[model samples]
Target: MACVVALLAAGCSAHATEAGPEITAGPDGVSISIPVQVTVGGMPAGDQVRVWARTYDRRGQLWESSGEFVTDGVGRVDVSTAPSTGGTYTGVDPHGLFWSMRLPENEQAPYPLMDADDVVVLLGVDRAGTTVARTTLRRVVREPAGQVLPIAEAGLVGDLYLPPGAGMWPGVLLLGGAEGGRPDPAYAALLASQGYVVFGLAYFGVPGLPTTLARIPLEYGLSAARWLAERPEVSGDRIGVVGTAKGAEYGLVLASTEPSRFAAVVAHVPSDLVWPGLGGPAGTQTSSWTRGGADVPFLRSLPARGASSAAPNQAIRSADAYERAVATASRWRLAVARIPVEQITAPVLFTSGDADGMWPSTAQAQRALETITEAGNPYGSALLDFPGAGHLVGGVPDLPTTRTAIPYGPVTIESGGDPATTAAAVRNTFSATVELLRKAMPRGRG
Candidate 1:
């Protein structure tokens, strides 16, 4: 056995020793979405050892996860397959440490509004409250060979990610949710590393865009699509759009209105009808979108029933409000507010969670699918409805899923779903989306 010396800062002697515990991490580095295999050895047989991880989030704040496990007969703990007895997460999970990370006690931090940069995680092995071994792991968002270019021309705001060694890659217009800012590029960077030209667009809440979600012009989305298609690095004919929540709603509307533009569509926690905008003035009712200088018809959110006793920071589920509005909407209003998904010419993939606390995404996705089917649309469409999962249904796989409710502007929004199930749904949905994109929009080498 090779002698391994613990860091002097960890209160260990400088001299190398073979008797102490040792941690080994494989692949040294990987994309943020990939999992790393971790094993701790050289410990007392059947003894309890704690494996802890520490990393800084995009905001440079500390985030961490730890698990206590009993070593095997041979004094080995394989984190990749071991069932965590207690700590930040429970059950057997390969990416538990990554997805179960949380802020330190009583530390209040805002939810990250931007994509995380490369993450460096420090892993330590604690035996009887003493650090015995440590190692480092690198998680990257973009490949070294890739390039990111900011787009602010033609009334579009976004970041275009070019794949490494690409000829002309399939283009993807990535959109964010009701948060209304530049779409986080973490997912786009990962997709770019996998050979897609992803444009992380900011439709509103920027210097050049609208200050809020109210009455935004739909033509902005179409203009962004047209600009992306014109890019030399993008295969104009093979373009797709991927959006989450309000962004999903926007993407569907765009595809429906301009059926020939998008070759593929992926909507996460999608809506079946056009709904009112957010972040507007108090007691104001306005459509979320507009086209050709006219306000698009939309369903207004019903008034909150009564004052709630929930704390300010507590997560509040808004799904009930949406359900009530839909149930009470008049036939004329429903006809006008419903998204004409049947007009979409491209293949569509809808992902939703039954437990979506933000909205009834599962029901809405089902309605959209039914609309297309009844219209006899030639293009195929499918829905991935995950039971028990919440509104946070899709994204880069293997990040922290422990927090279902997070601070959004002033109030905390409860996205629903527990950590483990939501983690699984994220992984599965991401894989399915990639598979669909590869098939529907193939990349071409330059």
Candidate 2:
């Protein structure tokens, strides 16, 4: 119907209100009565309520449902889904009525759900039986952990195939290209087969989550990581992160910025900086890298505000601004480089293609790798070189695509980065991540 979120307002809640309807939910949906009183600015309405929520996915963000849940004269509402479904659903009404739903299950917990972000059970009301109260589900999901947490937070939104008793299998977080993370990609099943729990995420697409890089938060990645650390089945100390392209940027940010959170980081065809770079003086450096060299420009552009010169979409989607964007990225990324490798104490596996078209120089990655190893961090760090792959690789000698963490290296690379091989790499990313976790575990280390 309409936005029930506005009806509730800040500091107000459907469950908290004395006159609020008694909304009951079952497996199919939520059921509530009529005369829904929605309060906004101390103003109350009888129908049509909506809220905003944040859902998460593998790559970064999930999605948000706009205008969900309605109300009736009886102050009752209903929903089509169950709270037991995955994803953390937090609702805020117009007046700021807030309520969050946490599912009882996790990704490796034998649940059929794939992503928690995917499930949206609209909350509604009868509307005095005159009109239907409607609202959108605006959601926001933050994934700080670059590894297993993505699947548990975002992947559980749908029906995924994690095996029973898979509770402690080492898990990995696989990052995708600039698009967004989806749990159903061919990789999910493959990772499950690898005997590890996985959490693929979509930090951008989730309703309340920012769809663009400008909207993404540094803490979002941190939160996911901490969630993984606190889990009982998973080896919190042993978690790992695997990233590709922009996801690689995030991986680098997470692994380097929060060194203790991850056991190791597998950065596939990765570049270091976070934003586009301008050439070095007419400028030569064009991108963020293997994590080094170049003076990364400060991306002061409030592009996410739809105002700046470096809007995430403009810098990423519109090639018209490629030259300008690269100049800007150069400034922002170099600054990020100064963040200290000591801070990134985790071991790192940097994979890159000598022939990548995505960047102006492959040498930057080489340098970044050197920096990672030279930092003398407590973890292992190595740069895996593939022959012909580009920014994303794991396939043949021709145009190296991807092979991030799940192995299958040159063989899979040789198959034109075959789906089977790609899938294998995805699984291997998780498996190796789990192995990394095991190795990091105090007992495993001893």
Candidate 3:
């Protein structure tokens, strides 16, 4: 370690100032462990690291528990990202491990790895990674309290999060943002922190899964809610879904359609109308794709106009393809899910980003959300937009690795803040949302 390396501040932002770290993948057959040596210039920081790593199969079904582990000295740790099965092993280590699920390979959804993935390490905050408070996660990731009873339907492959202790805890199904692809522990950590048993499961991953909007279904989400309620530790009847981005539409689907499953929801950066998908640019100004940042330019690498052009292709259908696919399930686009805002039966807290540039339904989502409140539906609806947030929970500025903005937003950011901070805020918001539900539907609780 160099005695003198530059650092930004004791605190960190998404933008990092390091030359990026090295993530080396292990051997072939077995799921490889990628060693991550985390540092902040001159500072040593492995003692304060927490790791959460998960990889999904080809059908978008999440394969395993994202390991939430601690690091050794030298501020380094290994996250096991590859599934036990065969495939290319591409693992990732999150900042807090609370939210470090980046889409790997040519994968928009996560998958098991057999070969090694081309690794790129992006630096954010410039400060050393924080060691998780030993008891911090134990407070949430423990066994359910009381006895976990069976709900109406606790079927196979359901994604669920259970909070510390149990019995009638506020519960929610966490939708992992748009595309339902990224690893979003933020929502789970947040809601669970606030005594909400939250299951933030992956819906899209693997190779054969139907990732398109038209083919996506809410049956999985519905069942998860019902199953959570049945848990002896859970007040399943009080279940809610916290949907973000495209997941917001799913949240609406649960609350409006399966009104019984979800008691209420706090949708962050939600889409009023579901389309193919929408997301913020992978602003990597400070990092380099050529070096070790995000490898795929994807849409994020395109100019704002080019990136924004996808809006017209909402259903992921071109003029001709739309006409062709319209006859089949692929084009009917369940993505354009109808919430019937006029008759919305569940309580909802709708949040959007003021600075998000990704939206095929930017105008439409705002209007559709507004229409619900205007209708005076029995449901409770409130909209909150971050001061300058893009699509993420942290209110960090929109910048790539090399061109990150010096943030001016409050430390308690509304948009994309750091992962732990984002989790904390979400937890607080979930607590408030639970209170609102308790008021609206007394029986909704245990």
Q: Which model scores highest in TM-score? A: 1
Q: In candidate 3, residue 13 scores what lDDT?
A: 37
- Number of the top candidate by lDDT? 1
**RMSD of candidates 1 onward, in order:** 3.9, 19.2, 17.2
lDDT tens per residue, model 1, 334-354: 998999999998899999999
Question: Please, what are the lDDT tens digits per residue for candidate 3 over residues 68-88?
Answer: 223445444444331112111
TM-score of each: 0.93, 0.45, 0.47
- Total backbone clashes of candidate 1, pairs 3 or more residues apart or in separate chains: 1
Over the stretch 273-323, how does candidate 2's per-residue lDDT look in tens digits?
Answer: 455432123223333332233323333222222223432222122212322
Clashing pairs in 1: 167-446
